[model samples]
Target: MVAFAVEHRPEFSALRARLDEARRRATVAQRSLIPAPTLYFGARGERAVIDPREVRPNAAGQVESLGSDHRSILLAADVSLALPVFDRAQAARARADVDALTVQENLSIEARRVRAEVGAARASVAATRSSYERWRAIGGAVEEATVLARRGYESGQVGIIDSVIILERIARGRIAQNRSRAEYWRARTALGRAVGVIQ
Candidate 1:
């Protein structure tokens, strides 16, 4: 059991890293849209003053030295300089789009990786299964030979040593077939898990 080492698979690790980075970028892009409050101030008019010459009316009602007709007034105003709040909704929608795309891309990559891993695992399982089947066939033939050899020895037609050798070889083939079968089943399980479609 060489630890299987599936956890350290490089392709899976790279996919996870890419997903995390996409999420982080989407988050940053979304947070950049909040508007900060701002204030705008400016002088609007000139100061007004009383005119002494306009205090007295003209004696002839037609002669006036000076008249105060156009006057200036000092005006101060404060206004909150805010971008139209409703416009922010559009930016928010864009942010949502970015986030959505990020999620979609990550899921897409994940699905692809899962499918690829499952395919590879399934291939391994198939090969191992074929080996197991081949070994099983060989084991059966060897077992039959061992049986014949044992009967021959009992009947004094063969030596005990040949019987023992045949039995050992048959056992060895059986062991090999058992090992292959075990590996095939283990690979099947791995492929199921990778595909997220356990059977």
Candidate 2:
């Protein structure tokens, strides 16, 4: 039944999702207190280099051309990081974020309510099942008696009063059986509701 509630109920699933989202937000807020690190990577490729030539003053103050040592492609990478100095407000907000919401407690209460409902439903089912079994068995037996009583009356072997009594017993048994069957279905419906199924 616990598995049934967890597996079949969309309300419980939505609650779990909401809790997960809250935890994620709390974690994000917590991580905001520290510096954020980043990684940078890049690559460049070219068939030919147009700006390969470069001029610079040599040891004797003469301009030198560096095109002979140039490559067609260039690659670059760098890492950057930043830390917020004033995080008092964010830290306070992170601390203010609560783990337990009123709705979460209400969900717990709902679980207990479901448990009680399921228990009551199970008891009703048990009671109705026995009632159904008893009524159906008695109904079958009374129906046979009713048929025998009618045949006996027709053959002048039984009185009209006896025949009427048997017929009445059969009628009462049928009514009880019908009621028991209906109650059994009603109990099953209650159990389904407790377990979070539509039907």
Candidate 3:
């Protein structure tokens, strides 16, 4: 989802516009490359154009006239197909240009956003890791203090307030541990989203 939304950012509209323009230009180029099929023949009269092979001998053994004019012979010559030529050069060029532009725009936006997200996630992980380590280190000290304070209270060497303070320290350590765990999970989730994997 992160990857998909990042790709759909509003700036992609400009890329889409550029693609459309390129397509339009390609259409014009394509039209221009369409070879006119009329280069070999010209039409003049009611007589249909005839192929040389269609000329037949008359009952009197004479070649038939194609038309009233002797100079009106339609010459058949080699005509080249144009689509393949255009596709190999001009159309292919247009396609490559559009592809490069599209990749630039899309990847630029995606990379910037994913990098920022990754940075934030990494920072969160670091902070949570530090907190977790600090809390774990203090946990043993807090428990020892709590045990000593309880013993001192029973022996009348420490007051109820002292015990309460020690218990509060232990409670605070536990709370910090829980908070750190939550933060770690949150950071992991953010990192997952940043990397485009939705676990």
- What TM-score would every model get versus the actual structure? 0.52, 0.62, 0.49
Best-to-worst TM-score order: 2, 1, 3
Clashing pairs in 2: none
Leading candidate by lDDT: 2
Judged by whole-model lDDT over C-alpha atoms, candidate 1 comes out at: 0.67
Query: Number of backbone collisions per candidate, in order?
Result: 0, 0, 0
lDDT of each: 0.67, 0.71, 0.68
Query: Which of the two, 2 or 3, has more lDDT?
Result: 2
lDDT of 2 at 127: 89
lDDT (Cα, tens digit) per residue for candidate 2, span 1-199: 8567656677777777776776666667766655444445555665544353576769999867765554555555455543445554465445436543644775687677777777888888898889888877777677787788789999998888987887787787777789889998888888888777864
Ranking by lDDT: 2, 3, 1
After superposition, the stretches of candidate 1 with alpha carbons farther than 4 Å from their true spots are 1-82, 85-95
What are the per-residue Cα lDDT tens digits for candidate 1 across 1-199? 1112234445445655665665665566556665655668666777546566675666676645365656666677767675555355456556656666766676576566666776788788889889988887787687788789788989998888877887788778778878998998888888766654453
